[model samples]
Target: MPVTPQPLGRRERNKQEKLDRITAAATELFAQYGVDDVTTQQIADKADIGTGTLFLYARNKGELLLLVQNAHYAEALERGRAEAETIPNVLGAVMAIVRPIVECNRVQVDNGRFYLREMVFGDPAEPHHGQALSIVARTEEAIAAALGRHGPIATGDAATTARIISAVMFVTMAASVNASLTTAAILQDIEAQVSLLARR
Candidate 1:
């Protein structure tokens, strides 16, 4: 039998509304001022919610960042995956998957670096942190899929190579030495490394 899902009750609707407001507020504030400069109280004020109420949505600012950036990262991964589908060359396909992510991370350099820190160090038990980690895993999966499509690379090799590529991308993006580099420059560096790695 076909079944229709029930609509959200008032309580659920209110919670969704509050969450939307919180996300919008945090996104704007984080973009304006890097995550380090923004406070939880400021976020609460921007959201027009009490500090205590904001805590219910996100335990801390790191989690709140995870909340905000996770969506953008997920979108970037999707775009990369779609672009990878159209490119047949292995390196080109991999770069297609990587370019959008690098662009997304570089959107606000400090925020991007801090989000990487939070993803690495934040409590995995936290829901938002888990979501960020999930996006990363999905990114690797997309890369592995791209590799698998191109040549005789075994599934295991593809997965391992994807992990290496992911590590290179993250390190290159987060590295202090590369901090001042423009997105094109960073992409060029990553492409050089990926080209070396993609050679089978």
Candidate 2:
């Protein structure tokens, strides 16, 4: 038998509407002023919700930033994964899976850096933080698949190498020293390191 899902009730619809508004407001404000400069009150005002209501959705500005960046990071990962499928060489394939992520993180450098910090240091109990970690896990899985596909690497080695590559990419992006470097320069550095790592 074909089954139709039940529809959301009034309360659920209202909650979803508020969440959408909150996400949109946070995305715009965070993009304009960066995460550190934007206040929760400002987000609430823009979302047309009370501060308490905003808190109900996201407890603080960091959480709000997670809510905004998680979507973008997920999209970037998918784009990179798709691009990686077309490249044959191991290094080229790995970098294809990395380039969009680096580009996404550099969109607003400060926000990107803070988002990385939050992913590392934020409460795991938080839903958004968990989503961020899931994206990282998915990224590593994609890289490991690429490594395994292009060479005679063992499954365990591929997974371990992928973890190292992910760490390298994230640390390079989040490092204070690389904050001033252009995206191309950072990508070059990552490619160099990845080349050394990908060598069989």
Best model number under lDDT? 2
Native-to-model Cα distance after best TM-score fit, residue 17 in candidate 1, in Å: 0.7
For model 2, the stretches where C-alpha displacement exceeds 4 angstroms are none
- Model 2 Cα lDDT, one tens digit per residue, 1-200: 99999999999999999999999999999999999899999999999999999999989988999999999999999999998999999999999999999999999999999999999999999999999999999999999999999999999999999999999999999999999999999999999999998996
Worst 10 residues of 2 by lDDT: 57-66
Write down the lDDT of every candidate, Cα atoms only.
0.95, 0.96
TM-score of each predicted structure versus truth:
0.98, 0.98
Error of 1 at 14 (Å): 0.9
Tens digit of lDDT per residue, candidate 1, span 19-96? 999999999999999999999999999999999999999999999999999999999999999999999899999999
Q: What TM-score should be assigned to candidate 1?
A: 0.98
